[model samples]
Target: MAGTVNRVILVGRLGKDPEIKYTPSGMALATFSLATDESRKDSEGNRQQITEWHNIVLWGKQAEIAGEFLRKGKLIYVEGRLQTRSWDDAQSGEKRYRTEVQGNRFVMLGSRAEQGESPESPRASTAQPTRTSPDQPLEEEEDLPF
Candidate 1:
């Protein structure tokens, strides 16, 4: 291959509300866990459902937006790249590594008038889409046409 691509796309439900924090530079960072389910046939032809969880992180303005709007059990589509980082454990003196998706863009899934949302709620009118760029201009995603 001439080059390698490190892209990841995920459509899943939020396991919990996004967590937001500010870096020393005052840049926003958000982290969340998404859960996806896969079904497979077992040896007896029985269907088995398995759930996989992914850690997702977004930076910059997108982080603030996600932290404010995204909630547990909300469905969303995320496009990003996979990254792994390592750190030394202070207690045990061992190296620890973790892999997570560094999200560039995300779009909320569902109708604007999703269940449990009031008609007058601001989120009810938004398609809930945004993109992150710490070093580049932020890009806004248009409402997805059903």
Candidate 2:
């Protein structure tokens, strides 16, 4: 293919509450860890399970929403691209590189009740409406038929 694509999608439970921060320019940034699991029968027929941890990042409005609604152990669906960054470790003075999912959009996977949220509220839907990328226009609820 002439063009290249960098994308990632993950469905997992949050390992902890999102950590929100701001840039010197005041841009919002949210970082969190997600844990995904897989189970299978080993050669000996014993059930085995494996868990993978992913670093997730979100920006702007998406970051704001994550700080407000996401909590440890909550299941979420994230869609975005993979990004790697390197920085010098303060104590060791050694360079360290980390890869993170730069999420442009996400959907909460479980019901409000399952998340310990109020069921009678208008935001009681299992999944939050899809969030657009920073460059894309955000659509109001009235614009959606559902």
- Scored against the true structure, residue 27 in model 2 reaches a CA lDDT of 73
Alpha carbon lDDT of each predicted model? 0.79, 0.79
In order of listing, the candidates' clash counts read 0, 0
Range of the 10 consecutive residues with the lowest summed lDDT in candidate 1: 121-130
True-vs-predicted CA distance for residue 120, candidate 1, Å: 7.4
- Write one digit per residue (lDDT tens) for candidate 1, span 1-146: 65667778899999999999999999888999999999999999999999999999988877887887788998888877788989999999999999999887777777656624566534421323334435434446545555
TM-score of each predicted structure versus truth: 0.80, 0.79
**In candidate 2, residue 15 scores what lDDT?**
98
Q: Give the TM-score of candidate 2.
A: 0.79
Question: Using alpha carbons, what is the TM-score of model 1?
Answer: 0.80
The residue-level lDDT of candidate 1 at 22 comes to 96
lDDT of 2 at 38: 98
Q: Give the least accurate 10-residue stretch of model 2, judged by summed lDDT.
A: 121-130
